[model samples]
Target: MLLVVAGAGAAGSVTFAAQAEPADPLAVYAARIVGDRARTRIVLEFDRKPEIAVRYIARPDRIVVDLPSTVFTFPEADLEARGLFRDIRYGSMDADSARLVLTADRPARLVASEVMANESGTGYRLVLDAEMVSQQDFEKLVNDQSWMTASVDATATAQRGDRVGQSEPAAPGAFVIAIDAGHGGIDAGATGAATKTQEKEITLAFAKALFDRLKGEPGIEAFLVREGDEFLSLSERVTIARQRGANLLISFHADTLRQSNIRGATVYTISDKASDRMAADLAERENLSDAVGGVSDTGEPAEVSDILLDLTRRETQAFSISMADSVVRSFEGQVALINNPHRYAGFRVLQAHDVPSILLELGFLSNKEDEKLLLDPAWRVKIADLLAAAIRRYRLPVVANGG
Candidate 1:
């Protein structure tokens, strides 16, 4: 309903064809998501010519089409009809065409979408049917937009010593473990009463340690979605995991509160309904990370209906809870435990549907013992080993149940 169509152009005529050679050769345009379930569609137009050949392929989690130098933008009206997608993202893949990414609110099954000739000339239309995902899943999709950054920084790229550039072979079937360091940059999380160490710093150190251990393990790989002490939106956290094709996502956090007795670790997965009142409150506070940090949530009202959103929420929650249990058990003896170690909260960062994700509170900064342990290198290594094993163990059930 909120399409940004200018309504320009005559009513009847449409021009269709890709130009062969003009003053400069025109490149055809293509769009598709680029991960697990690769679904692709393309459109080409020219004033007086036709395109030669373009290559497209469908991967397990994404769809990609390779074309000549071309840029793509959404035609306003068609975008409005989509109640499913939260955003459409793209960047230049190379000097050739661009890579288009779509984030959907609910999991979707792409029946068919294409750009072809109409009665008058040429046009583009894409169609998709929604596959219901739980509210947890939908929220993860919504949250992902914030986690991803378009960094093409050379030094950072070089720092990624083993990372593949655009031309490298896709890391197919590589087990993806999503690492989330609970708070970042300005978000100090919990503070040590005695040592005065920040929770953000401890979590980042621990996350990086775990990432290194995962990388060394066979058949397993890991990456921290956030590399620095930068403020990242919770949704962006989930986006990082999904983009990396993570099968399991683990978010790290260490916090403090007035309740001095509270200590030890806890594992949390997303839930449509919070598991307990305390869990609900914790989730509410975390969800407001963006707003609390001074980002405005007040904006133009969404035209999407409430009923449809609720329907999607009903679909994927149980899987989220299962992930929490997987992690709590994984760290059983190696880490300290909190009351009812496995918990459920409405965390935006733990929302990806296809991937099972959980948030783990490494320990409470309120406790002196916990704070010291958090700063220890030995604890980081032990915790990382426990975490990696849990990820590999969790995969068995997910594959049998979902795939």
Candidate 2:
């Protein structure tokens, strides 16, 4: 006895409704969209009442919905782009948060959003109605209301405070190192020209090797940002590292470049500006992981106006440079390194203000020789050992001084 609109303008279609408890405590079982350019309706059926928070973003007009820990069980095709919505995406923001982003072809605002028990009385429905709005109005909305959630800038400020009051490490302090394997799930990164080896796979393999090598070392604790083929936003990566209390974060990547002849391992640290055109171009593409995964940019402000946070970032950047230098020195005779191996760029993944971070390019997949070396297990092991040595050398003084 449920009226189901199978698709846009499908008025006669009727489907029986079935409700079952989802294994997860909270979940979205179904989703649909209807209507046209000027206005639209979005409906989602949830297993239970969900606490939802909404935010409006401009530049490219979009609406973001934040939810508590919840599983999305609906078919991807269910939320087809129609009406005012140009694109729709739903995914995990982190371990505890999920997000739904709706991008519009033009400025649009949700005029109505409500949750109510369904006719079956076994589930709940979240209904949203959006309509086109003037660009001026949208801009007004964007400026008038402040997003209350902890944005990247706010989180970094909090982290700055955390570092200020940090206590000395225990005897033989176990330094936590976060190994982030770049590009996974929907974002398949760059491809190897010869072997067609996915960059995600290569990065993951090297991350595991590095983690395995570091986990057994004394005074070191290592954790992977991702365990499998899963997508994580750039901001989410930073959040995870900070949550893990990581002292250092090393993100591994194997990228392909336009110049096929250019290839070697390179180390990158975050900077306000790129050191060179190549670094800038690479950072630009790497920052688009979220867009590639169908998620709109959060459009949250990145710059922190707080003086304490700025100071923390500067100090962290220095430590990152020191770590990068250590890596370059370790790879000098042991592994092939790019000219001026250490580079700098505005990499979003390295934006954790209190945690020193570096992104290591294992090799360029564009070069046949580099790709071959990247695929070799023995070569990966050798690189992992060298990286371990670098980390150990870098930590010696810090550990002795009670980091």
Candidate 3:
């Protein structure tokens, strides 16, 4: 990457010249973090009718953002004081959209999201809401036992001792993980035009790998929506996560787009408008995965009761972002970043009854460099190992709590 000036008269800064020919007007992906009633929040931004998407995912804590080829103009001093973000990054993830990943000191929230054309209408503006959480309350939420109730039941069933060992017929431990491998039997997600690797297979393999690593944790366990190759409706997937009383959910997948050179790993949380063009496009594709297999979003989620549940929603959202930070921190050096690495999109699998969730696109089948990593068992295992370690570290405090 080289640096150059920006204007004829305006003092040119050290901005790099266009790295490559601009493909189609790429998406302008943007997001922010906020504090909820009790949780951390994340808000995303983008311009015009850019494709965008969002979702809430569990496990390894994080939010993912994807955008078309676009340049970020934030300055060093401004970023340093951005309290909502624990840390931030940007780089050429692929030909399209530079990815962004923001790590948080604690769980936060995503709120006050809106997208519209500027009054002048020459271009667009994306706004985000990032809130801060007090340390004491953040700790309280982390160690809370209400969510840990499942562990107590599992231990009682074992009776003999802890649920770690001894086949108690009672399955596994306290926390349940909802693993979603995007696409299914008949649904071949994005395909690599050069390598012909289907996204369905790549995602399923990654999900299973992550699941396998979570098996031995003390208060944690996991479950998959589809153990084998079969098309399960999106609602059914949600049902399965709730059925197991999961505390977290993680969805896995790889997608291909017309932007062949775009690629990198992305973590996604949930949002209605989506952050940018790429995020919106990806969310659309993922939400439509079931359609390829003859299923549809029934638009029926269980009724929300117990206003207490509302109290925890914000807390849960914060926890999700905190978790995402851990994963992003671990990804440093191990992999490259897309301009706005972490993004938001409307992902269905993340819509659980109460489970905190995260969806990770390990890489893109669309980019040649990324495609190579996605197909590499070594790379896959490395990422999975990092994820498992991060989750383990992320949960230690919770485990310490009386819960």
- Judging by lDDT against the true structure, name the best candidate: 2
Order by TM-score, highest first: 2, 3, 1
lDDT (tens digit, per residue) of candidate 2 on 257-344: 8888887878888888999998898888888777655443665447667999888778777778878888889889877777887888
lDDT of 1: 0.50
C-alpha RMSD (angstroms) for model 3 = 20.6
Error of 3 at 215 (Å): 3.5
lDDT of 3 by residue, 1-403 (tens): 0000000000111211222434564443444444433344443334455443322212212222334455554443433424555544433332333334444445543454455676667556554454545555444543453244335323222332221232223244475566676664445567765566666566666677777877866666676655544345566566556655555666677776687666667777666668888888877777765444332234547667777877566555566666666677887787776677677777776655355666676767767777767666666667778877767766666446522
User: Residue 366 error for model 3, in Å?
Assistant: 0.8
Displacement of residue 37 (Cα, Å) in model 1 is: 54
Per-residue lDDT of 1-403 in model 1, one digit per residue for the tens?
0000000000111121221222442432322322322332223332223322211111112222222333444343333323444443332322323333344444543444444453456543332223445455434543453233122222222332322222233276556666666665434565676676666667677777878887886655666766665545565565555555666566677666567777777777666788897678777756655432222242222445577655544444555555556667876776778789777776666554444456677677777777777777777778788766766676676566542
Candidate 2 Cα RMSD (Å): 11.6
Q: Compared to the true structure, candidate 2 yields what TM-score?
A: 0.63
Compare candidates 1 and 3 on TM-score and give the better one.
3
The per-prediction CA RMSD against the true structure, in angstroms, equals 19.7, 11.6, 20.6
Judged by whole-model lDDT over C-alpha atoms, candidate 2 comes out at: 0.72
Ranking by lDDT: 2, 3, 1
